[model samples]
Target: MSTKTGADAEMDAGGTETMTVREAIRSALREEMEDDEDVFVMGEDVGEFGGVFEVTAGLMDDFGEERIRDTPISEAGFVGAGVGAAATGSRPVVEVMFSDFLGVASEQIINQMAKMRYMFGGKTEMPVTVRTTEGGGMGAASQHSGTIHTWFAHFPGLKAVAPGTPAAAKGLLKSAIRSDDPVFFFEDKMIYEQEGEVPVGEDFTVPIGSAHVEREGEDVTVVATQRLVGESLSTAEALDGEVSVEVIDARSLYPLDTETIVESLEKTGRLVVADESPISYGVHAEIAARAVEEAFFSLDAPIERVGVPDTHVPFSPTLEEEVLPGEEDIQAAIRRIY
Candidate 1:
């Protein structure tokens, strides 16, 4: 990771600076590729069409087709190729297009890329980054929108990271590219245009297994991931004098920062996990389990989980909003906990 002073100096130039979350991600990839000859991006429509969401826009002209190669709609084939490339000393960033499409390449991800290091007795490294978008709000339907980070986190030897802001996205993506293990990077489709203060320039990396404290309070602790962090923050503000809610963004789900969460619970003695996934066997369950194991003595009441109903994500806007967790749901959970 680069020093804060250096990052600030790079951002001080100030020349038409605002960028969206998607644009910041594109910039991170561009900087990493320019710095390291071994780093290359390969995925569907990444070369000619600039990716499905325009996240990889105009990379083919800059780095040429070789580094920014496009491929058929074969998730299994290309994902396996990426895993092979990583083992052979090349850094490959594979975009799975949509999180729902990951099922087509699950074997390559779970068995091959994830188990390579252990299967080889730590003789080889798999430095592959699988980037994909998930969650609702774009009317992407059930197949295109789903928060399945918990599934990847359940697997060993792989890391899962979901950034809630543009700055975190850029830094974390850079870190993922340089990692020696496979990573599942989940991006929220709704936050594509969401903007934040990202320090410009190169060599900026946010380490994995760390959580960010978005808001400080004393009554209750709300742990959230991805765009849910934004919703948690809004709910915190709305509670105002009624409740002192602290928001903790669990940026990395796999190597979770349980220490931060436990410490926050020590002060607040109440917890609420706000996740945008199904309630049953989801990330919130893991978090609640950990809190119980580590912070049971500190907790004043039963831990609460704010998440979607245990049903498939609906396509209708009204039904989807009801099914998914929102600010009001979080607020209600906070009231219960506090």
Candidate 2:
């Protein structure tokens, strides 16, 4: 619904369309599969069930069971198979139903998939894209709902991205699939249904390691990820005349894009990092550390970090809501330094 802005303008041109995050992701999978016979999707419920989040909806019908494979309820097995497939010259797009379960396959992901190419002296190719849903707000509880992208982002030899909009979801997914490196594509589950404009071509892709400035302002700069990107943008829009808050969608977490944040800080001199990850030793902490190292002299006040407290997501909706940072949290964080 964001109209006339860069996000909207990108779609207004020919070969662009509007869709939901989930749809965009599915579309990206379709395009990649069509473009490459080596590209295939494997995950639980990905084939017949069309994915737990329906991100792979209709993919099986289009690509058949061979291309859209459904594995057992074993995360370690399927994820390991994906790593093997990618190493053997096939581009495997694996989906772990919930990112929280990624811990089950950490050995294969961290030790094998992430380390293969580097460990093999550049002999191996890891064009594997692991698509996993993250974030809380659906009350999926600690077992199902969790923001664990920081684990991959912090780990070396692996690239990580968390897109906040439909266009980003589509473009980034395609980029991850085409990448010759292992890319962890973390999609915020809460935003899957969120609508936005996306490019309509198979060749289009949002470059990895770049940040998208959703809104520009000369005041405080808010570097946000996942759900917080849209929330912070809405908060900024609501405070149009009262306070000018610049919002940046941190699409790529690993390649933190410190240049964009530093440039914005050079102008605004104030920063608040909004992440769905925990407040400690996570995405927000890394970004804040980069800001301090790069733009410490430009900072006008203490950098604020808005995120979930260091605790498991509670099963109770009220308790979950209490811990998850929201628009109010972003607004409050922005106001603290002003």
TM-score of each: 0.94, 0.96
Q: What local distance difference test score does each model get?
A: 0.87, 0.89
Clashes of each: 0, 0
Task: Please list all clashing residue pairs in model 1, or write none if there are none.
Answer: none
- lDDT tens string, model 2, 192-308? 889876877676788788787788999999998888988998999888998888898889998778888898999999999999988889998899999999999999999999999
Error of 1 at 159 (Å): 0.5
**Model 1: per-residue Cα lDDT over 54-145, one tens digit each:** 99999999999999999999999999999999999999999989899899998998889989999999999999999998998777689987
Instruction: Give residue 25's lDDT in candidate 2 (0 to 100).
Output: 92
Among all windows of 10 consecutive residues in model 1, the one with the lowest summed lDDT is 1-10
* RMSD score of candidate 1 (Å): 2.9
- The total number of steric clashes, by the backbone 3 Å criterion, in model 2 comes to 0
